[model samples]
Target: MTVLVINSGSSSIKYQLVDPESGEAIAVGLVEQIGESTSRVKHTYDGEKHEYEQRLADHGEGLRFVLDLFDSVGPSLAEAGIVAVGHRVVQGGDNFNGPALITEDVRDLIEELAPLAPLHNPANLRGIDVARELLDVPHVVVFDTAFFQTLPEEAARYALNREVADRYGVRRYGAHGTSHQYVSHKASEWIGREDLKQIVLHLGNGASVSAVVNGEAVDTSMGLTPLEGLVMGTRTGDIDPAVIFHLSRVAGMSIDELDDLFNKKSGVKGLAGENDMRAVWDMADSGDENAREALDIYVHRLVKYIGSYAAVMGGLDVIAFTAGIGENDDRLRAEVLERLAPFGVKIDPEVNAVRGDNIRAITTADSSVTVLVIPTNEELAIARQTMDVVATLS
Candidate 1:
């Protein structure tokens, strides 16, 4: 049987149909620029890709276009034998620790938790409302935050007044949990050790680091929201909370202004006026002081996290680097490993230079801690969890 995984974003619908038994995607497609007059749908199946440009007024219309493409391009849904549908719900807000069947109550709960993930939950619900209308099947919500539910109280809780924090629902709810789960498990399998203490560095445009012990999340970098972790492409990470108050009182900046400033105008973008790491590196190579400083700060922040996480877990066994930057940038990997000499983490220069879609060990054989590059498969993780959740019902 095939499971359809739907990752509904604010303006896009990314989908894949996979056979849980085989773990291979039968079809993949994306409907982008929803609500725009000129939108596009790119569908791939049977080793051939087909693209269509049309007016997708909204997600519903875009979804309709997607369905039409599936019919036109072949591997029809009926032929695929889709049994259930899975949705990537970004923030479960401490309510759901795993995938849930999309009952009315689940839908309502997803809607209610919108405040926690203002930019994601609503859009996810929008897709849910549309997907339920379009496909009459058992729908499941695979939360991105669910895998991190294993985070201990000390790591999950904030150092704030318990009363106020609980009242406002504020704490460290790390993001990229789905990716962390996928790669950590993959790394464990690759290293032939299930209980190895691992650090997953998912360094994408929106970066996050997770401390996973024995395939369970113990700690993570992101907190309460996606904007709180390691310095991201745009969002400023690990800033003094009082900076907001200081700016408001002394600099006369409004809270909303501060929000936009930190979330959009900051990070590498704020420092070097470029959010892309490649561009930052380029500028640094060209002797741009601002860009050079930005790179230093970014690497320094990551170094501190690596050291602290090793201490938190008592010790480290492996370092699994995944996602865009971590998997591709050999220089950055070398730089970070160079700082971890005391941790006995040494990378083979030749091994570190390799890059591909498969799992790889970049560290030398004698290195005390294994260092690996594993590609993340979050959508497949969602699909597997969705299948597991549905199997329990049977």
Candidate 2:
């Protein structure tokens, strides 16, 4: 069986056709610049890439063009036996704890929760709407917040005014829960232990960490939104609330301006003038103080989270790193583990330096904590969950 996993962003649609049982991405494609004058579609199959440019006025148009590519390019959806279409919904709020079959009511619920993920949900819903109209197969919505639904109250709730918090649904509904969930399960499987105390650091352009006990999430870094956690590529994570007030009063910034500043113009970019970690490292090598400081802040925040999550879980059995920076950047991993050396963490420098797509351990055999670099496959996770919902129909 195959599943087509679609992740729709504000102006792009990223998709993968996957065989969940084997975890192989049979084909992958992306449609960029939707609603723009000129849009680009790139599809890869059978080790070949097909690229094109056209005008895609909206999500419906973009998806229609994608379907056309599938028909013309090869690996027809019907020939591939696509069992279901999986949609990645960013925020399910407290309404869904697991993947839900896309009924009209579920679609409505996703639309209703858009305010919580203003930049994501609406775009996600657009894809869902267009896909359902374009394809007759069962469709499933997999939420990024579903895995974090298992978080304990203390970890999920905010310490705010009770009435105000409850009324506003103000709680820690984490982002990137899908990646966290995938990595944690992969870690457990790699170590051959289900009852593990795991701290999963998903460090990419967008980063978050989670503490999982056994297979359930106990605590996560992101709270209420994706903006609440680690020092991301362009996001100011863990900023003091008073800074907003100070900016408004002293800097004369409006709410919209402050929002733009915090989300788009901050973090590593604000500090180093470059958002990419590789660029920061390059500048640091050239002795750029700003770049060096950004790298230091990024590593420092990661170390602090590792220590805190270890405390939250009472003890740590495994520390798994996944995502762009986590799986690729050997130096960052070395720096993180070096700071954690006091806690009996020891890295096999030789093994850590090797790069590949497989899940492997970087820690020494006798290290107290088994540190691993596991490649996260959120698309496969979504496809599997989509299969689960499809299975229920029979």
Q: Which predicted model would earn the best TM-score?
A: 2
**Tens digit of lDDT per residue, candidate 1, span 246-348?**
9999999997899889988999999999998899999999999999999889899999999899899999998989899998999899988998977687889
Error of 2 at 302 (Å): 0.5
lDDT of 2: 0.93
Pairs in clash, predicted candidate 1: 173-224
Write the residue-wise lDDT of candidate 2 on 1-394 in tens digits.
8999999888999999999999999999999999888999999999999999999999899889888888999689999999999999999999999999999999999999898888889999989999999999999999999999999998988889999999988999998888888899988888888999999999998999999998999999888888998999999999899999999999999999998999999999999999999999999999999999999999999999989988988999999999999999999999999998988999999999999999999999999999999999999999999999999899
- Native-vs-model 1 lDDT? 0.89
Output the lDDT of residue 247, model 1: 95
Question: In each prediction, how many residue pairs overlap at the backbone (N, C-alpha, C within less than 3 A)?
Answer: 1, 0
Error of 1 at 150 (Å): 1.4
Residue 182 accuracy (lDDT) in model 2: 89
